[model samples]
Target chain A: MVKTQIRFGILGCAKVGRKMCRALELAPNTTLYAIGSRSIETASRFSSENFLPSSVKLYGSYEAVLDDPEVDAVYMPLPASLHLKWAVLAAEKKKHVLLEKPGASNVSELEKILDACESNGVQFMDATMFMHHPRTLKMEEFLDGERFGRLQYVFSSFSYKASPEFLESDIRMKPDLTAQGAVGDLGWYCIRAILWANNYQLPKTVVANRNPSLNKSGVILSCGSSFYWEDGRVANFYCSYLTDITMDITALGSNGSIRLHDFVVPFQENEAQYFQACNSKFINLSTGCEPARSGELVRADLPQEALMVQEFANLVANKADGLKVGKKWADICRKTQVIVDAVYNSIVRGFEPVEIMS
Target chain B: MVKTQIRFGILGCAKVGRKMCRALELAPNTTLYAIGSRSIETASRFSSENFLPSSVKLYGSYEAVLDDPEVDAVYMPLPASLHLKWAVLAAEKKKHVLLEKPGASNVSELEKILDACESNGVQFMDATMFMHHPRTLKMEEFLDGERFGRLQYVFSSFSYKASPEFLESDIRMKPDLTAQGAVGDLGWYCIRAILWANNYQLPKTVVANRNPSLNKSGVILSCGSSFYWEDGRVANFYCSYLTDITMDITALGSNGSIRLHDFVVPFQENEAQYFQACNSKFINLSTGCEPARSGELVRADLPQEALMVQEFANLVANKADGLKVGKKWADICRKTQVIVDAVYNSIVRGFEPVEIMS
Candidate 1:
């Protein structure tokens, strides 16, 4: 018999995990089964603060949560450095893995986790919630349709100003914990958006900008890159921990263009919108364009994170019903990781062009 | 005696010159004094088609317009390669020069034109009309105020898909006429927007993207570049003649961000708008941002082009009153040309970093 609801065990008390806990509650096919922290007191505190059901289990260690027979999946929101070990262990324990973004320090480490998931016959997905938003689907339709011809250029930016305390104590500022720094934390989304715009085709080359803002520990706080394809297609992205909040993507095609100011997180929870212009041309006398860009609004039945949880759980349920593991999410995660690795490598090589191996 | 109205002469019957002809008529302190082309028949045809006043003069050669004592300023919409010859001649004849962009083939040629203007006591300005739009002034206020902290990053894109006939015949595709091609035609606006956001401070280095689409004549059809400054400020821009019409600029600062889609040409001629978010932060639970971007609309008393003509006329009128030639427009044009040269140089050197000399 197939399980109707997937039981999710969250393995960290990170601030992002609080949002995921709420997502788990909202997803129809997912339940918050367990909360785990290094100390039982922390787990209990998180459970009480989030108002988890009394039936929810509390554990002092991630290993205990992974060992629980009733937990069908694990949501790991740990630091980037810990992803490979815990994500691999969760997959080895036959639990579906919904790991947080910046999936691993590098693609090599991420591959190890993917290998374990394949051997364990479990689902593996990175929690890029924005990908699950209905607005993304609407934009994809425009990109793939005839109105928007071949994609030629894409530009994305993701940034937020960090407070003084965040700069001093956030895990992202530490070289050992989030080694990729702003590139891993904020750039992951920008890179993913670029890859998505290009139908997951990796760029021919990547070159990071030279003037990266680095902390005293040499961690990148801000950086950008230009991506090039063999077909003369180009993409660029800027990510920073030192600028005001901005999430934008502008994708242009031979005949159309699409722009969205809030690609990562919509301003509102229930609805999101994007602007598109097809065959826009200047009017007579070049006073203005003939057809102004039109905004398309998409309504979401559930929050983006909740929809992500539902999607992950549906895959896990199908796997439990004797179906083969779906590879789509894994493939998408790998592509995003490869670009992230290439960007980091380019930065390391003094802003030299780094060809994508794939 | 100081002239109360600046009489404008236009060189070349190029398509853009038609727009400026209309602008001269609309500007309060300017008049369409003369229309010049390679042939008198062509100039007469343009004058009749554009419905010029019966009092306007027609000239068979650009030099004829410069020699006309009644013409106080000349708007030269000649090809990029011809600017060096015609702009210098116009200035030598004591005609204030409002040259269409890209001002010249390179800074070396532009400097010669500027030198002639300064020695002749005549004003020099590029016809980048958007710079004079009231909306730009409003956006500048936001960028210069305390609401937006130090500018850290700027990204701009300007592209338009050209028809097959255009690719085959347009001067922008001919290296002899517009050697810079898309870089000069479209990228000029993007580079100008970047420099405008940064207060005309030239970036320290510019590196072109590796994949630049080139025409058969070796003219750039599409290209992009990443700019780096010593203070960790960065800017990137993409320009193309092979994509849909898109004009965008997103400038991010430490405390605020501003975005506008129609930066080059407003959607409507009468009014323009931009979006800004100051001190925006994610609300509790990270569900959504607390302050959404607010759109600021600016109404134009005259079209941007007309305002540009009026501003140029005012400068010339002041010069006629024995005031020194204003150096601000000249300085702006020189800085923009410097970056344009650097971007082309970087592309020529196989996507290598090219440093700005001044």
Candidate 2:
């Protein structure tokens, strides 16, 4: 029996799509089967610039990619507004959906898309590449250990200074194209991180910080939110399109603390460093080694994004029980969307705390 | 024609006093003149343990040390409850006061102590040694530079896991001794860090996190607060006596970000590291570092506490200009107290936002 390769079709020519195309090529179990754009010239240009294999097919419309019987999966990197339409159609076409995140306009819309994926029995996963990194799994193991004790507080930040040109013309800054703005762009990862730390426990309430900057279109350029759990566990996150690039996650537990400077994306493609300390305290002589520093360096055999594609493809190619939807991932995506909505609601209500309804 | 050395007296045999005694010895313009404990036996034991100079005097009572004409300055490491009484008496007795933090129960009590110090013309300084570190001056220079641009957000945390014995019997856990508890101990450093980042601009509002762990005596063990400025600048601090040692200060400015893992006390006594990024942003290829990375390692010529002793001694020894008080330090101490009070008030009022009066 020959090994089966999941053929993935590319949707749109977004900057992120360029990275996804390379990821598909790098993923051993996935092949770049097709490319789709509004115009064939644009599709051709993307394929050329990305150096796509000549065997890859090109189409002028996303519908053509979904229609191709050879394509087992469609990777959608469209704008947030377009995700609801394209993702549902891809799922309806019985193709696996590897959708870029801010999965939908909101939780309700994401629920609808998830419904389609569930009904169609197609594997669904978000393109949150960092989640697939070995480092993330290692950190989770540490967090689950007794040495770290009970986790109490978490802080995550993801921000980057968008160029003036991007701020002026990028689809992310257009209210109609991406209604959630930076909330959906950067906050998605931050919320996902908080939930991941808590074993995907949703917070009871969320309050946005009061210092969000908005573009002329009333799109968020920068924002933050604080989340509170029933057990007095707290998490806050900051995201921006107007600061130096930063991705941090700091978790404080009863007996230890874990810190990572680069969480959304590792500083390097293959390795990442995180700091953890257990039973830390200052000893005699006013010097502290109780938080004896442990710099954990996690190395990945493949780049995280490639690993993400490979993982998604593995689910799609799992013929033991035929292809089935990754229901937990869809649930996780919906929970993340709910939090994004809660933060947006709080910001809309002038920074008032909003209860998150499960 | 003789360069008059400021004679120092240490009150109480608290663990911190051990460090202060060494600082006084290291300071070029200061000499350990006396040590006062309730019993001469205890004072003599402390002197012997600390390897003090043979010329140092021992006093059985704090009042006797204050009464000694040669004791030009008194380093008060007594409990918070005694600060109001002994600090005022030390000032009234013409001895400069180097008081440990949480100088008093509240701002009102600290105000009285400050008033006495000002009226008596005796120098005053808190033993927040990090403030006197040469690295602090360097950080300030970076904050002042155009490259760092405008400061917008600050996060500070200071925490350490206290031994079980300390939790049960330390003066810090006793309401009658240090009423503010963790808010007075670790939180003092956190608040000072925020103020230092903002150039001492007090926030308009303070809101404590809902989940503060309180001891049986109603003294705080762990707490956090968020402070908001009118111009949308925000700061937050987390402090605990129930977690591993962690001291971090991260300041995000318009053009850059500055972060130090060891802010309250340097990881090493002689040198410390801080990371800063100016004009940072993400570029093409999905990898970051546009702001680039700069790791600044600062070396201290003398320990921070020794510098604090020397600075305080300089003011006290300026007899040619009629020995004057370090008035600015007194004001800083007062402002820190006001913020601490605001956090405590907010926590007490069900986590409601409290306005900082000053």
The model with the greatest lDDT is: 1
Q: Individual DockQ of the candidates?
A: 0.84, 0.57
Q: Which stretches of candidate 1 lie over 4 Å from their true place?
A: none
- Per-residue C-alpha lDDT of model 2 across residues B309-335, encoded as one tens digit per residue: 998888777743564434789989999
Q: Encode model 1's per-residue lDDT on A209-230: one tens digit a residue.
A: 8899999999999998889888
The candidate scoring highest on TM-score is 1
The lDDT for every candidate, in the order shown, is 0.91, 0.86
Compose the digit string of candidate 1's lDDT tens values, residues B1-358.
7787899889999888888888888888999899889999999899889888889899998889988998889998888999999999998899889999997999999999999999988899999989999999999999999889999999999988888998999888889988878878899999999999999999999998888999888999999888988888999999998888999999999999999999999998888989999988887688888687888889999999999999998888788888876599999999998989889999999988898876
Clashes of 2: 2
